[model samples]
Target chain A: MMNLSRRDTLRLGGVAIAALTIAPARARAETEALIKEFAGGKTPKNAGLTLDIPLAAENANAVPVTIRLDDRFSGARSCEEFLLVAERNPIPEACRFKFSPAMGMADVTTRIRLAESQTVVALARMSDGEILVRRVSVTVTVGGCNG
Target chain B: MLNRRTFIAAGAATVAAAPAIAAPVAVTSTTMLKPKGKKPRIVIAGGGWGGLSAARHLHAQGADAEVVVLERNPIFWSLPMSNKWLIDVLNTDYLLHDMIGPSRKYGYELVQTEVTGIERDKKIVRTSQGQIDYDFLIVAGGIRNGYDAWFGNDEKAIEFTRRAYPSGYTADAEHVAIKNKIHNFKGGTMVMTLPPPPHRCPPSPYERACVMAWYFKKNKIPAKIVILDPKPRIMPIGGGFKAAFDELYPDIIQHIPNAKVKEVDPFNKKIVTTAAEVKFDDAILMPPHQAADMVWRADLIGKTADGKPTTWAEIHPTMLHAKEDPNVYLVGDVMGAVSKQFGYYPKSAHVANYIGKIVAIYIAQRLKGQEVKTLLPDNLCYMMVSGEPKEAISVQFDYEIMPDGTISQKQIDIDIRSADLVEEDHKWAQRMYGDFLA
Candidate 1:
């Protein structure tokens, strides 16, 4: 006769439930939150923003990431500010950049300290009071900087 | 006759049960294989100045029956001439090269894997991929900066975590950050902290300060580059560097000896030291270091009674592994014998290259079942100081093994200057990069 520990049984049940429900729900919630934050409580439908991260990072400590906004900042009603937030960090706001019409297009590059594998969102606020947004999930196998 | 038959039957039953009892023993014994081959399989971890040189030399002499180079990083960086890149005198591309290119060229297998553990009894090297068996192992993984231990919090240390510039220091983020801080200088107090002795590039921090001071004076910026060292004197090139500091940037640069940074208050831009509170507009903190994680994790190298990993390989003067482990050899900064890291007692890339050649010879001879006579290694370090263009000082020494298994250093030359040494430095870097990556 064999015996199964209660803890082991519970763990198996949890794994099955996680495989069936938790992962999908977490992904959906994360996507919804990112969109809401980017559009300032509204859902964005445009595709003017692009995010780039390495397919695979040789050194986890510094994973190079780049974000580009295709929108032009020429008129008085141009882009005013940009915010980058991570879903997993204790503090979600990884970086925030503010720009003026005279400052030019939204292009900036700097290393961000990531806590773990999570969704990263880039949100831009236009001078016309419209919020444009984009989000991408980066899987960091090893956490550097913070570790 | 009946009693005899009964006893024989019982003995047979006992013998039948013996196999079942011995099953676990057999499984354990079969899992561990004894190291085979006439020459030990010497696996050198890290292809930095020390490990690469050891692998190349071992291969050349055909000493190691099988030589395997395990380097985590794809490239080997030249530490000595790298200063040129700091001031835009040289490019970062020229300072770093792929170590595997040379290992393969030299007829050795360079395994790029993260080594996780070492099994001494089974003579196996454990990695994320699988277990690699080796008769001997040399770990030249170099030093690991204990920044976490130095700084109380990880968040405050983020600024120094990666390269500030895309092209400077190549792979080093801290180097790039220091360069950026220097470049964007308006005017304020600049503090450079130096760890206690036995670090890679002894004169590096001071040299950096000198260059920055030179830049400041050249631009006539209202600034001062202050160096805080934990040592009584400056370092390896103590006198020469001090003289240069005095002559070049008299009032602009200040050298404060025996001052160790206790804390860094980023919010206030101040470094709390044992001596006094040093405030600065910008700060470059070089933290203390220890043997890399793999070395401590794998107990192949002996540790002190206090549990600290010995600096040099605890082997005899011949650099062989101590205890019963005859196949392993230790060299360079990882070895506890030398107090100073490379460049102090010939810990330069040139010296490491020379030692690598010697280790190869020893390995080849041992592979052929020939007795290897102990060989002494020569050390050379070229120190580059920043001024108008660049100036350097070179030190060369030879190690002499004494009786009772002790080794003493014989200084061959010190503070030797030359106009063409810069060219020699460049040639040395190229030759080393070519030879190691070859």
Candidate 2:
């Protein structure tokens, strides 16, 4: 299960990056475009929303992800819809969760299926025409016996 | 697993498990860690791996002295291979042992009390119970969490962080809390942070992460374990650990490189790192670490003529004696054992136990008016990579001390993960405990 190739001696503060099957450029661009379309064609700022997704999904069948509107985002930037997109999936659009200011905290915690190695992007369209976003890289690979 | 019979059988078992330890290089200590007094009283401060090694050796040789061990904990907690205790639902019997057995067997008086201060000027060790005098002191008190950099002047925040999410690297109670957290994980993401370098058990957090990932996956839980590493990559056996993350638990483990924990929001379950602000359902926060408080009071940490400081104690790499005081030795994670060929020495129990014995021998020789040699410690660390398949990886380091006082290093990494290595992992801990305690 392991390779003994006489790897580099251990160093501090950093280690070698493991190679992973990366999604194609075209697919990534399309995924970003889908995220943009969901944000009403506006580029989302990196600040307001946090998209917490697994760096790798053992079971791509149902990968759990959490999207939260940061408390720093005032009521003026309240999100209406939060869209999740998987770049390398056959269907890039996973689903969108509707949120309301009445809900107090606009957030979504759900699972979405992903195919090959891809990037998961979450976008939120605020009430004031401002958009917020976050992206996480999920390396979809074969999991353990059960996963 | 070591009962009375196993204690009697420890010698043969040592021969069966380990090849003979290499020659030792050491110098004398007077007042810090253990108890060997006749011509000279050698006081050891802590009852950790390093302290016990020195205590056992000094008393067993009957170095014509009264041997005593000043320990804080009533029981001894074995850290070697204790990572399994975090993920698997298991009793601590394997990791915990009665200190009385080793103390009685070795004929070292065990003082179970907290060390309040080390009065270096008077050569007196002030404990919670009382004060003890020493000719030489071994300050093997281990490391203290350096949370000042992260939460400066914020005692409430620090207290909250320690209670809510402990790194479980040092204390026995924290390990039990984390083990329960793993066993009864409700759902959502679990986070574990890796300290920068020179932390105790370099590969431990990684191995523990791997084991927990395997546990979550095996149990069919849709849980993700995010590893926020201060380092840019997995360290020590980097490639081997990286491979395990890539192949075995790629989906279950999220390793964010260069994510040094800068701020911790305990109430909100969030931590701001150099790279990202992470929000976790639960997290094991590994606060930055420095030598124990006793060392600071003793003025052992490297300091300018004024009062600037380094985290670890400044000690001779080979001799392990504090650069300022030859009689006051520092061992274990407390000392900065940097090598010329390598960087900081691996702060593993193997190295601690080995260096402890060496330090004791030096004190013994000095007590008898004999010369001491300059020997270095060898270290071997085993990490369990998976649980279902029961695979593990190991690393070995053999050191040589040059005439110039520079350390020459040789390392062998058994990077390949195998069931056989996992078997050795358990045996290694057993033999090590048997060696010192039995």
Candidate 3:
């Protein structure tokens, strides 16, 4: 096990306590509703969804993120809708990406605004009725929003 | 009463009689080729600090010159304020502004085009769009990373992709990778390699390490940022950077001087240096850089001893191209003059703006069939050491032309760590950017 110094322990404890205190029941329900709306009531398997984000973002204003899906976009079956949500942002829905089969890949790269250090979820719905979900926890030292 | 024609006839007669004594006059006439119309056609390539400064200066002089600036990048990135972005003090947006909008304000044409080559004989610049002719061409495209052959094969090495970040130095994609790599780092060495001299922002790598170490300490990340520099001393602002590094983040950073990265063992995260084989959890390698692709493609660039295109362009004391063509001039990082290489030497937008004014004067004199005058450029570089806003330093200098037509510097150091310096830096940035961008 890695040894945690006094400062490290305090920082970790502060982050953990903040997470516990901020994970309100309302936010959880809103996130659940968003996921459902994103997937049309279908729960997606998280295995095929790959989320690429920094473990820690120096500035919260613009964090580069890439969402890659392993699902194949064949004839009539494509990644139609994708949504990005952060647990801490006032506006939970950061952005939405819409794509079609003719666009080739189910990969998108962009810089999103993060409010705080929290888990970000990217949910995608395919034309074949398959839902994909990916989550990455980014520790934002300074909030990018409201600055 | 002597009219303008009589003065011209007398000048021509004097030039024809005493060629050696009137050499300066003849050279002046060549520079002062008047435009057919009221406004002279000036085409500038590269919208970096130098090119923007030239465009702004031409506009400020109120010269009858139709200035057209061709920059590959759509936006202008501020090098001075970029350090704040690395430390999370400033957003990327704070360091970037629209180059096109500023060009319009300055009454210059901003064309987004990739310069292919320059036909010096034909006095034409060949771009991807089409060939553009100019009475005078100012090249200020800035530098590009040459990572080919540094890490085994180019394909094997992680290709550097530049994304549109507010700060031009640190791209969005690169910052994401660096942040992720640094955060996940646990009790291992981290290396930040500095490229050889004549690169942009000399003290930047050291400043980067300072900020990174600050974050490491704040987050309690058990990692040390070891800086590998080829130069014997910390660059441009050597004393100030050394003082800050020692006084602030000494425990978090290990300095390795006179060392160059020989090879990289990517699988093991080990870099073979001239001194020793050091291993690291993450590495931020800044390879050697050269003039932009367009500059290297042109024959106007100065060559190194090994025949590679050195970022430096050899020029007359007046800052015009020494040979190949007299109408073309180089400024900023690519000027090939020794003083321009120093980061603290007026490489900032403020200084570039002044240099542009000098270039405009030279061009205007040449257009009027008059003698072109030698320019003495002012150097000013402002640096931000930390986010506390008190740890900034600004260096100012005035160039003195030497007997051999080279420029020697007269240096003035101002510590901006005080409250007054901070305000000065901000004011200077505002004033310079307004003038240049306008």
TM-score of each: 0.62, 0.68, 0.62
lDDT of each: 0.59, 0.73, 0.64
Ranking by lDDT: 2, 3, 1
Q: Write the residue-wise lDDT of candidate 3 on B247-358 in tens digits.
A: 7778888888777778865556677777667887777777766666766666767766799755656666454554566778876666664433122233345445666667
Which candidate number maximizes TM-score?
A: 2
Please, what are the lDDT tens digits per residue for candidate 2 over residues B1-438? 447545645543222111111112221233223333445667789998988988887875568666567787878887776777776533578788877778778877777667788888888887755567888898888888887878897999888888788777775687777877887887799988777776888338889888888888888888899999886556555657888998998888999998988778888888898888889998888887788988888888886457778778889876789997898998788887465345566777877787787787778878888877666666778899888778888877655555555764545556678889887777777767886877
Query: If you superpose only chain B onto the true chain B, what TM-score does each candidate give?
Result: 0.79, 0.88, 0.81
TM-score of 1: 0.62
Error of 3 at B132 (Å): 1.8
Chain A TM-score vs. truth, each candidate: 0.64, 0.73, 0.75
lDDT of 1 by residue, B126-155 (tens): 664345688667767666665655565675
Top candidate, metric DockQ: 2
Q: Judged by lDDT against the true structure, how good is candidate 2?
A: 0.73
lDDT of 3: 0.64
What tens digits encode model 2's per-residue C-alpha lDDT throughout A1-147?
222221112111122222243357767777767875776767779987898876865435446689998863466656788888877776678888887677877766766767666678888888888888888888864231101
Residue range with the least summed lDDT across 10 consecutive positions in model 1 chain B: B162-171
